[model samples]
Target: MLSDPSRKYRPFPQVNLPDRQWPSRTITQAPRWLSTDLRDGNQALIDPMGAEKKQRFFDLLVKVGIKEIEVGFPSAGATEFDFISGLVRTGRVPDDVMVQVLTQSRKDLIDTSFESLRGARAAIVHLYNAVSPAWRQIVFNMTMPEIKQIAIEGAKLLRDNAAAQPDTDWHFEYSPETFSTAELDFSLEVCSAVMDILKPTPDHPIIFNLPATVEAAMPNIYADQIEYFGRNIPNRDSVIISLHTHNDRGTGVAATELGLLAGADRVEGCLFGNGERTGNVDLVTVALNMYTQGLSPGLDFSDIDEVIKTVEYCNQLPVHPRHPYAGELVFTAFSGSHQDAIKKGFAAQAQRNDELWQVPYLPIDPADLGQSYEAVIRVNSQSGKGGVAWVLEQDHGLKLPKKMQANFSSTVQELSDSTGRELTSTDIWESFEKRYHLKGDGRFRLIDFQESQSPKQQDERIFAGKIRIDGVEQSVSGRGNGLISSLANALESALGGQLDIIDYSEHAIGHGTDARAAAYVECRVGDGPVLFGVGISRDVATASVRAILSAANGA
Candidate 1:
């Protein structure tokens, strides 16, 4: 035993169970999730999106139901002002959507910030200044009293500008820059001074945002500061306390949760943590943190993929695969053990329909974010039977009986070994269908077809068709006024029989002129209707008939 050169050892990385503390309350429901994706997210970009891209991103934000969009910091730079101008000139902004403009407490910037929102229906003018001891000494070279003066002056400026816009509603928001690092008493003093000068009414409540700009301490200390402010801040009933934390501690989410628990009401951050230095708190992670806990984030950001695309496009940034919720691989498992466990968990869950088991395999269903279920359980070197089966069940809606799982698992292992790359949800679905689907080599085959319409027929749009099922040239025709109806008639005559047309859909394959056209249909057999399949071709009618045969051939 002593002569053995190699020793049984285990060494890599291990998370100490004792050090882990899953926060009791995940997210505060009462707070509004004001996405700074367009502003902060844009600033974080190496190649910041221009006004057009910004507008497109803004449209997506609005579509996703984000009520408060930090549209821009019109005071900062030329590009920003131009973007703000575009929003104003086009009259593109929605009535209910509050356009938030950020600016410092400085006179020029405040003037510029207000100038940007001239024609806005409603707006929030956020004024901020550095007030921490270190910030005062290093940046402003000012003492605490001097900083307090600056805050009061800034507050007065905001009040005047807001008052000037009497025709439009303006809610005032003040931020004590580097708040987490600032002395608690000093922060309270400046924030209180600000509120006093502004004199926030109940109808338009004042918001005091404490930012952990340079995180110099643990999350608990930050929580303590929030609690102290929450308990001590005067006229808080007539105001809303907000938090903006950074990820220097890698505990932005944790800090945010603690801060809210200690009494902050609003959160401002980028979609996936894009900002100065290490970045501001990730709004997606923070917002979804509450959403998963059964709290409404006041924004319907269920389609996370679309959200990420907008963030990526505007910020010109790539999301870390490990990032929570919106990351490319957040819901993906590529480890052998993880995949195996997930596969088993899904199997167990499926076995007992009587019990709804929201298992650990996926923290959140990708479908919740408007993501298709295909990518949930992907196959890789780390994958096994359970993972493969889950992939099939979720993506294809084809329940993989446990017996077939082993073979599929083997195929997944082979693919993973071959590629040396992680397969995406869409990739896995395509590969799996190609390999195992019955339609790949089936009895029915579509040879050709066509359709013509005048938009004149009642439920008929002039369709005709042809096919070569079992190599017999089956020429068929119909005069249905609608495309779907004509195609249904064409298929019935071609097959020398009739099948129920269950469903049909036509959509653009992709964007632009290069986009291939596609069509899909569902046909009923003896009982249930099965989804038909089709491919991209110039001939539209042929595509429709192909769709029917795909289902007829047991696709």
Candidate 2:
């Protein structure tokens, strides 16, 4: 790293538009989207998609509701030309979807591009040439007039070819390739010259795709540039402004959004921002961002997992685990506080009368993208009582009491720390069974239990039960005000200790005749620490009795 970076680098200049309307504008609708996964994205891949993968990806893009796709640069080679030709020859292109092919300003390449789309019902011919000063002086060694003539000559070729092929619905797209860093007026001049040659009307508009070939400035500056062009360009109604931004500065998506606000009509990018250098603007992020803002993005990502799988297979690159809406862990929460808030948010969302989605730490609902809630909250050493309880309730249908949640969380935390790894729902459930003495034999086991009301005192109850203590059978009896108290009295008398019931709770685990009651009890024996117990049975009374015995066993 350089100590004095300013000496070697200069800050990008800002657009001189103090009256920029984009700053106050909001995106109310989705712009037209064009996926370049087969062209720009394929060119950037280490192992580009073969014919089969390209066909599969094309089908996927169609399934996801993308109407415009840049198929490939037909003039690149036989493989590129053959793929575009195959889509046309086989009649695979849908009636509503338009396939686009790229070409340079050369007449031979333009002829090849059109030949590739010979029999297509509708197609777009995209012609691009570098117009920036750096490109003119360093790359091409040409002046501004020379660059403008190149664009004009290409537009002429496009117009003549479309005239010859009247049966095909042809749309023309002209890109001043380095528009982001080029002089705005020079870019406007080149586009205006092309428009004059194409002679586009409002019904047949010419697309002027302005690309941030290398993102150099802030997103707001890019918006200013778009606004300035839209305000000054001739025949605005006959020109569709499109944005193709690269992620050179990691702001391609932001630039595209701001450009939309600046009155641009379309966007072009890959599915997961796959392209040259850092990558192109992520179309998924831009579209879903609109979805979150209460506007329909016009694209369906409902089965996002399938989309990820297809994109990964075609691109041969894995989507980052933290990618905006499609990543695997985007819906998961491991932090204690985040999990607690999300648990509470789900509860509140379920009880709401309206359809608005509101949840903390999650900007969009995972279920909307075909993801289940089971992965939303996971248990780890960093998890708290609420997170642990959430896992139990979601997986096992046991809503532990507030204090009991805290009590059991410590046991889970100890195991998590010892194992030094995340715990699954099964691990948590098994630990719960062992902690509450709900599994296997314990110190005291109930063989039979019966209770009846006292005739002399209606409020008093006589409790009698047979139990096995360390393999020894015995009869125990006591009198108390209620069934629970009477059972406590009998246990204390036989066990030789003062047993106190501090807390007790019970609920049905399921529905109808098959339902079973779950009971939880917190008990203190003599001077020992309070212990928790759990029991489940078809009879509520029996479940309570086993709960008390389970707590005693803990003592």
Candidate 3:
């Protein structure tokens, strides 16, 4: 890497707009979206989509509520032309949806582009030419007027072709290929000349696509350029200003968003941002961002996983596991602090009465996109008590008390650290059962138990039960204020130690005929530290007695 990068590189110039209104504006609705996955996206792939893959992708885009789809550049090859022709020939194009095809500013290519969509009900014929200074001087070696004439001629060809095919509804789109680096005045002049030849009306609007072909400046500068064009363009109501931003600076999504606020009406991109270089702006991220801000993006992503699978299969590219809303790990929390906050957020959300979504570190609900809550909090060495407790409650229906969660977290932490890996819900539950003696016989076991009110004291209760101590059976009897207290007394008398019940809690594990009770006890025997015990049964009283014995055995 060069230590002095300024010696080799220069900074991009800023847009000349002092009073840009986009800064004070907010996006209130979704823009008209165009998916260029089959054109721009496939062109960038090492292994582009074949006939079957392209058809599958087309079906997916239509299912996802995209009204305009740029199917392919027909003049590129027979494969491209055949696919577009098939859609028209087979009557696959829906009445409400429009298929768009791309072409350069030439006679034969334009004719072939029209031939591909010979009988479509409606379609967009898009034309583009490079007009940036670098292209004019270095690539084409042409003057500004020569470049402007290319767009003018292409617009006329597009107009005449549509005139001949009067049966198909035709919409024309013109793009200044490298508008991101071209002079604003020259781009406007080219578009104006094209619009004059097309002679668009408010009912039949022309589309002027301004692409950040190579994202050259900050996003705000692009917004300034868009606002400038919208402010000065002729026949504003008869033209729909569109934006096609690339991610060269890793800000394509940002530029598209700001451009919308800057008065653009349409967006063009691919699913998961698949295109050349850093790829096009992600339509998924931008749409979901709008959804989070309470605006409907007019697209369906309810089954986002299915969308990811289709895109991966068609593009032969794996979507990153950390991609914004569609990634596998975007909704999972493994950090102690993050897990704790998310756990608390879910708890709070369940109690709220409103319909709005609110959760910490999560801008959107995973369930809204067909994701379950089981993966939200995973346990590793970095996890805290909240995460462990969440896993237990969600998977096993064991709501450990606050103190119990803290107590058992250390055990789990030690296991995770020693194993040096993540622990599944089953691993946590099995360890919990073993730690508290919820299953199998330990040092103490309850053989039989009975409770009755004392005749001497109306509030006092008597407990008489047979308990086994290390394989020795014995009968023990004690009296106390309640069933739990009397059990504690009986255990203390038989075990020869002072048992102090510090904390206790219980809840139903399930519902209906299969319901079972779970009881937790925090107790200290003599001078030892506090220990936790858990017991489960159909009878609440039996669960409580078993819990006392479980804790006493630990002592």
Task: Give the Cα lDDT of each candidate.
Answer: 0.70, 0.88, 0.89
- Report model 2's TM-score to 2 decimal places: 0.69
Q: Score residue 64 of candidate 2 by CA lDDT.
A: 92
lDDT of 3 by residue, 21-41 (tens): 999999998999999999999
Candidate 1 vs. true structure, TM-score = 0.65
Model 3: CA > 4 A from native: 375-555
Worst 10 residues of 1 by lDDT: 12-21
Q: Cα miss at 368, model 3 (Å)?
A: 0.9
**Runs off by more than 4 Å, candidate 1:** 1-30, 351-356, 372-538, 541-555
Which 10-residue window of candidate 2 scores lowest in summed lDDT?
A: 375-384
Error of 2 at 449 (Å): 51
* lDDT score, candidate 3: 0.89
